[model samples]
Target: MLPRNTVDTTVLPPGERFGMWLDLVARTSAPLRVESAHAADFAARADFTDLGAIQLVEYRYPSLDATRTRKLIRQSDPELYVLALTTSGIGTSSQDGRRSEILAGEFTFYDASRPHDVCHHANEPGRTRATSIITLIPHAALPLPPKRMAALYGGRMSGSEGLGALLAQFLIQVTGHPEQYHAVDAGRLGTVGLDLATTLLGRNLVAEDAVPTEVRRRALVTQVQAYVHRHLGDVTLAPRTVADAHHISLRTLHRLFEAENTTVAAYIRDLRLARCRRDLADPALRAQPVQVIAARWGFGDKAHFSRAFRAAYGMSPQACRDGAAVTARDVNDLASRVNSARAD
Candidate 1:
């Protein structure tokens, strides 16, 4: 789980709100700036938070002047990936040595790590309504190469098709039903985000091969692994069962695992043993018997589980559990020292 903090500044003076926004960008490392035609009445509102591996920012800009906006972007050099969807008004943006005019019903993406500028001009008074959803994710999280992503920057990618369309729709849904998402759902959303962004950006660059076969294979494997881990307690967790859940034939499923050099049963056993090892190390679980923890991770036979755990971690399950408790204490002690030092 990750901490979530929200700041809504529609109530503040435009100048004060802008200042507060600058402070937020500084703290979050999201380099962005805004200017309004009626600097006094113009409102800027943002909902920003970190969801585990991804940072999400949703913003609305109302009635802004184009020239003043140019100055703001020149100043904030935050190196991050940004996706901006315009819900209303007309604007023009330039980044990565490319410039494009943005109209209503259009969405554009750019890289903020480099310098970029966007100018918004409303058609009439109180007419501008632009909403943008920006994400700050680690470069490594994207399966595609940076050069491929750069090619797609400042260009209009199809958010109206396949996974991109679904993602765009999902974002709209989340905005409408923010309450529907819980802490756990945010992580899942982040994963979907990775897939959507990567897929769209890849389509834009014509770099379909940028995504390696193994990486795609691993992604599927990870999904299956997570599903198996979650349902390990069920007695019927087996290869055929996993295939059915994913809507793939057993032959296709076997082909997917071929690159991993392991069968589905072996993979499940390995993951179950790994989870058991982790549980055993937890001091909170120390009171529980080794057999109980083994059963929890779906090890029906205690002796077999013990042998596997020992082979994997080079220690008996009980010794590993005891060692984990000691390690947890050391970690807690170090954390306390760091906190004390910061306080000083």
Candidate 2:
């Protein structure tokens, strides 16, 4: 599992919770004057993942307002690019004399060297807390020029599609599933995240030519990955089609995956099998036929899919699903017994 530091303020006293939370944020990223309605009885948690040159933090808390004043900046500055995405809330930020509204599934970029105000609100009433993820990158780590990058300060970047979406998803995945990766994978994932950010910024500024060739190539590969994911349901999603869709030669496509040490077919097949495996484990989909589930992920033949799934997972699809069902039943039974004991 990747290294992570988690701080949950709920363990502290009501009065001390907010203070501890404030101190955690200041130490992790930068100092800010944060005020929350729930501060009197605050409950919040943060998961911090250090990715060498970059840092990713996921914050879950009630609605709050925070400000990084010029005075605060003068007192302490990290000289970092803070890109925050609202995963389950509505937010607005002001910087560079501009105020940008950040709806759910959107992000805002700002510099820690300057003053900014951010307000995050729960998307609807009765929600316990709003959620967001922040990616902190050193100013020098990004390949884009400072002057051009400045144009994006306090601007909304849609996470609904394109490079912005890719970056947002990358942050969520890296922070959410650190256990799936080794510590050595952190720096590489950070680089990919930074490359996606540069691509998005450069494309928005109409300065794609300004981005380095290597970064551009990596960004193209990232885009290709996204494209393949979106088209995984299409049985015709082959290397030739993928290359043509990207307007690149088949040989170039092969070369790109070569860097990842996999062929295009293997990549696509692995993804499909993984998806199939996930669906099979889903209790709600228990009634769904194995053949139907297989076909849903571009597998037209059950025998071929079974063989591939066995090769990948070392178990037949039916056996995998059966194991999941048994596990789920055991968990539910345990919960019921615990509840009964509590009632007694």
Candidate 3:
């Protein structure tokens, strides 16, 4: 796995929690003046992951207000661009004379070398905490001009659809399940993140035509794959539908997946089969009919699904489920025997 370290303020004495957090934030992130209502007994946690040229930090804390002033910048400037995506609660940011309210499922950009104000709070009742994932990218690493990037300072960006959704989902998945990725994936993941960020920014600025063709292509492929994964259960989902949704030609879509060394239909089929195979092995779904499980994954023809399952797993769906049941029974019987022996 990539190098990751977690810091929790709760581990320190209540009186020292906020101080330690402040220092830690200054070191891991940029220098800033930070305040919190829970300062006396601040409860916060953050995970910092190093991804080659970039870094990702996931934070969970109570209401906070932080300012990156000229003094702080003069004290230590990282010359980095920080993209703050709030996963929960609401927040506001100000930079370059622009202030924007960023709600949950939204993000904003700020430059560490410039002055900015950020506040994270929950406007809803009964919610006292806020969560966010921050991405730190060095200014030199970004290909866009500073003037163009400056226009986005403190601008609200939605993570609801298009490139924004893909980037948001990617960050969330990586932070939520770091164990799923390996150290070898760090550089590749970082490049993908940069590409997606560049594409999103370029699109918003109406300068996507200026982005490198290869970067745009990679970002589009990633978006298409995400879309396919999300609509796997839709029987109407096909290569043409995927192409249309992405506003690309069917031939172009085929070419994109070709670079991945797979056809669109084959990709969808493999994913559906994988889902069906997993469901068959799940004990909770044991009582469910095999056809129902297959149909749920867009496999309309029972015989076709059965044939596909057999070809993929070398076993019929019923046989796979029965095998899982036998294994489960064996484990349970062994456990019961061990308990009985201990009782005697």
Candidate with better lDDT, 1 vs 3: 3
Evaluate model 2: give its lDDT.
Answer: 0.89
- TM-score: the better of candidates 2 and 3: 3
In angstroms, the error of model 3 at 122 is 2.9
The number of clashing residue pairs in model 2 is: 0
What does the lDDT read for residue 165 in candidate 3?
87
Candidate 3 is scored at a TM of 0.88
How do all models score by TM-score?
Answer: 0.56, 0.77, 0.88
- Candidate 1 lDDT over 1-344, as tens digits, reads 23455676567866677566556655655445545665555466677656555677766666543221334446654446776655556678777777888765555777666656787655646555566566666666777787757776676654565445555665565554667677667777777556656655665677767866664555456557667877987657889999998888989889888887999988888888878887887777779999988888787887898888888889999889878888888999999999999999
lDDT of 3 by residue, 1-344 (tens): 67789999888889999998898878854778899988998888999988877899998888899999999898888789998888888878999899999799987999999999999976667866799999999999887877888888999888877788889999999888989999899999998898898888888778888688888889998888888899999988899999999999999999888778899999999999999989999999988999999989999999999999999889999999999999999999999999999999
Name the weakest run of 10 consecutive residues (lDDT summed) in model 2: 21-30
| Candidate 3, residue 64: lDDT | 91
Residue 125, candidate 1: how far off, in angstroms?
Answer: 9.4
RMSD of 2: 5.9
Q: How far out, in Å, is residue 29 in model 2? A: 4.0
Model 1's TM-score against the true structure: 0.56
